[model samples]
Target chain A: MPHDTAAHDTAARDTAARDTALPGAVAPGTAAGPAPVPAAADDGEQSLARLEAGLDALESAAVSDRRPWWRIVLSRLLPPAVALAAIVLVWDVLVWAHVRSGEIMLPGPGDVWNSLVAEWGPSRIGAAVWDSVYRAAIGFTASVLIGTVLGLLIARIAPLRAAVQPLLSGLQNLPSVAWVPIGIIWFGVSPATIYTVVLLGAVPSIAVGLIDGLDRVPPIYLRVGRNLGARGLDSVRFVLIPAALPGYVSGMKQGWAFAWRSLMAAELIAISPQLGPGVGQVMKFAQENLDLPLALGSIIIILIIGIGINQLFFAPLERRLLRTRGLSRS
Target chain B: MTLTIDEAAQARTLTETAVRLTGVTKRFGKQTGTPVLDGIDLAVAPGEFVCLLGASGCGKSTLLNLIAGLDPVSSGSIEVSGGRAALMFQESALFPWLTAAGNIELALRLRGVDKARRRTEAERLLRLVRLEGAAKKRAHELSGGMRQRVALARALAQQAAVLLMDEPFAALDAITRDVLHGELTALWQETGVTVLFVTHNVREAVRLGQRVVMLSSRPGRVAREWRVDIPQPRRIEDADVAELAREITDELHREITRHGRVGVDKGASGHAS
Candidate 1:
């Protein structure tokens, strides 16, 4: 786009040209004086254009050019980039040094790649991914629901808080994986055990997070809410919850971490063919077969899936909440 | 929010009282610590502006809190003809989560206004505070004066007959404070709701109050009374307001310098139980 001064300069040049040409009408052949005047007119117009451009430039922040579309795709692929490269290099180095074993023992990256492709078209690998996704989702949802209610209770009720504050903190310190044996005994290798594991993992983090969030809310907001006629649950819903969003989001992030880790641990310990071939079972199978590349590949896939879920859902949710609340830079 | 002014007036005339306090004493627990507000008797006639002035820790805020139904009065009865009193704090105390418009809307929501009327009512209150253009701005984005104005609008939206303010302009700069004082008095006169304002600034009391009640500290009690006969638009430096302020301030000094005097005054007023 041309600068705003360009038009202004043209108008100035027109006026200058008119001033010089008015006397030139008397003698057209004697064009030397007119020639000098036109050049001067051009100079004046150019200066005017420069001045106008400067003003426009000063008035606005420069608009930035968009990055290439390739960058968007590259960002999505970048997390797995180093792992992919390193694995390839390791496989090549092992084979070149004659350290690679047979297909079932210390399998090469190419062996795992072939296994993934062979399993892909049959829909089995897709089913496995979806199975894990669905189970984890159910567990996560249940934990969020139960954890939020318990957290709110602990935050609001004096007696409950007194009874539960220390217990909650203590429970949080105990790893959810430690409860796997009990969860298995209680609910067997079914989704029930999976959910129990997930809840145990996530609930404490969420509740603790919510408490932290609630604590940070200013006392003045409570006073204001009351003065505005916010009584009982209305105050909590409208005032307390929104005011503590940052804490809530952080709590959610922590809860997701617990849930993901717990699900992986649960599946690893309580694997059954009846329970479906999820990522944890795949990891176990690869390890038992002594296929190092396949084991590493399964591990890599799980990490990628976890990160993808976060980036696709929770991260965006958090970013938007922060942006709307002006907690994030615009 | 259901405390209707029309009903309050009809009830007051029928019942013959707007607010009545008898033997109200607020005692904080400790061996060395004294009662924040020892004993007090105060009565507010309808459409009156009473300024409560004292030093810090004189229980000015405690008094406001009690009247606003935020806390129970210890050892005394505070009766309001209005069901509940609306309160404004020194800090704007607006919810940062809500925009200026949204803050006003919360009050309206509590008042049982439906979704449709909330926007219009919020806009009306915003204009009343001379802030029609700032409705969409978040609470933190507003200037201190603007935030207080939004807070005032929210309080007004509560639709209570009594508006209790605890140093609502204390955090504001002088020019904004002066402007707000004028705006407040004008609004008070127009609304005709009883006002009980608490402040540590003596001249603010004289400038804004029709009757300034001087409070003693370390066991707050009514130390003295000054009837401010100054007309509207009075400045703090006005000879009349300053002269009255000096007189009251000297009494405040006496109250602070000495100990146990506040209790004696309370007992004499028959406000000590």
Candidate 2:
């Protein structure tokens, strides 16, 4: 018993001296030292080995099995539906509580629905939607062409990047609504005014998006491309552009939002008989007439259209790009 | 006398040499640090597999880049007889956005192959790498070994006389690496492309190469060379390979130790002790 006690004491002293000699070596338990150190290292190695094995197994399994189709559909569909239902329920409760009595002040869901059915006919609504969509399409298309070229120039040319990069960032943050008055003053409440507003609002983000994407591309890719004899325009077209696609696509999505918002702002502010009524103009007309249900219905329509276009067009493109690049988790 | 004899032999084989470098020196900047490669002279014969073995900070990769024309040599002349050389990195360097076929196709297209031939040629190369089924698979979808094989296929698509590889299979698992070594040897035999492979692993160099050249780091220079006349299909764990690796590793250790002493980095040696 005496010998055992002496050996234990010696071990304790040795541990303490070691701990003092090398600080922070023993992490959690300073009291239990040398004995635990080897054990911890062994444990760490085992875990690392296990983790490596697991990853290998996962990589092999990943080759055969794909993300299930049903899971994709459910993920896309279920949450949005539930959220929409909850919103409708809350809106109904507010209306029942008489928060603001009368259709002019706050319209109930049924009232909005009735007003949409009665006042806004299919043909009239279609024309309004067409007007807004056509204007947005033209503006967004122009923005994309100009923005892409400008972005490529800025990304490649150092002096241009230095000069324009800060201005683009500033413009991206500036609300498109602020451009409506200037646009009207310049174009005098014509279709040109709306186009000008959309261009001003959307171009900055698209150009910036391309620049950001190009900047993030690894230098190794360019080196590899050059080694393969892809020089100048070919390198830019094949290597830089494809590598920068994800960022560019995201920037385009943001640009679309800016374009859509600017078009609406322009339409609302610069309502003209010659310009024809758009969804935004419909809302303006509703507001002037104090028809809250019509206004709410028009807003609902606008929201649905925006969400629909994104889900149908931009989302798929973005998802496909990310999937091919192996950037997506699923 | 030995250097003259070696040069005489090299001169006799000059007509068949796929790649030749004379007095190659690479400096990063004007006077910031010592030159990475100092007076490097290397000659690669047609269809020969040469492994460049070195420790960390060796200019092995830099040497490959110079041969591949990815970077210009600071002072020497490099002659690659076969058009531009194709290079494969430690990483697959495959475009993640491209499918295996697409990746190969791009190389073919860049090499001036017509549109009609790209698909068939890409398929042929994929079959060469024994990855026929994976031609349509995206880089992310394939296993690491498969990706490397695809990368190899893409290199093959270049149809260059020489292939420059920078530790291409170092990232793979032991089993995968072994499998790739076999595939590479077989492909090398079939394709008959001159290969200048760079690696730090002694056994891997001995196993894969007809000749192993060791480079010492810190102003990288050729320290030693061994002609491994070992027969084909040599295993990484073979007795002969292990024996050669042990000898080379000892030499490598000596070189490292010499460098350590010369550098006089007291803190580094102290930590080791």
Report the C-alpha lDDT of model 2 over B13-71, residue by residue, as the tens digit: 65578988899999886755678999888888888899999998889999999899887
Give the 10-residue window scoring lowest on summed lDDT in candidate 2 chain A. Answer: A27-36
- Give the distance in Å from residue A294's predicted Cα in candidate 2 to where it truly belongs: 0.9
Candidate 1 chain B: worst-modelled 10 consecutive residues by lDDT: B263-272
Global Cα lDDT for candidate 2: 0.83
Backbone clash pairs for candidate 2 read none
Error of model 1, residue B74, in angstroms: 2.5
Model 1 steric clash pairs: none
lDDT of 1 by residue, B1-273 (tens): 456987887775635555677778876554345677877898887767899998887889998888888887768888876678899988888877778899899899988999999999888777566566567877655667778888999999988888899999999878668767766865675566789999988889998888888787767887888777776546677998889888888888877756555445654535545
Which segments of model 1 are wrong by more than 4 Å?
A1-118, A156-163, A320-330, B1-17, B29-34, B259-273
After superposition, the stretches of candidate 2 with alpha carbons farther than 4 Å from their true spots are A1-59, A66-71, A101-104, A122-124, B1-14, B265-273
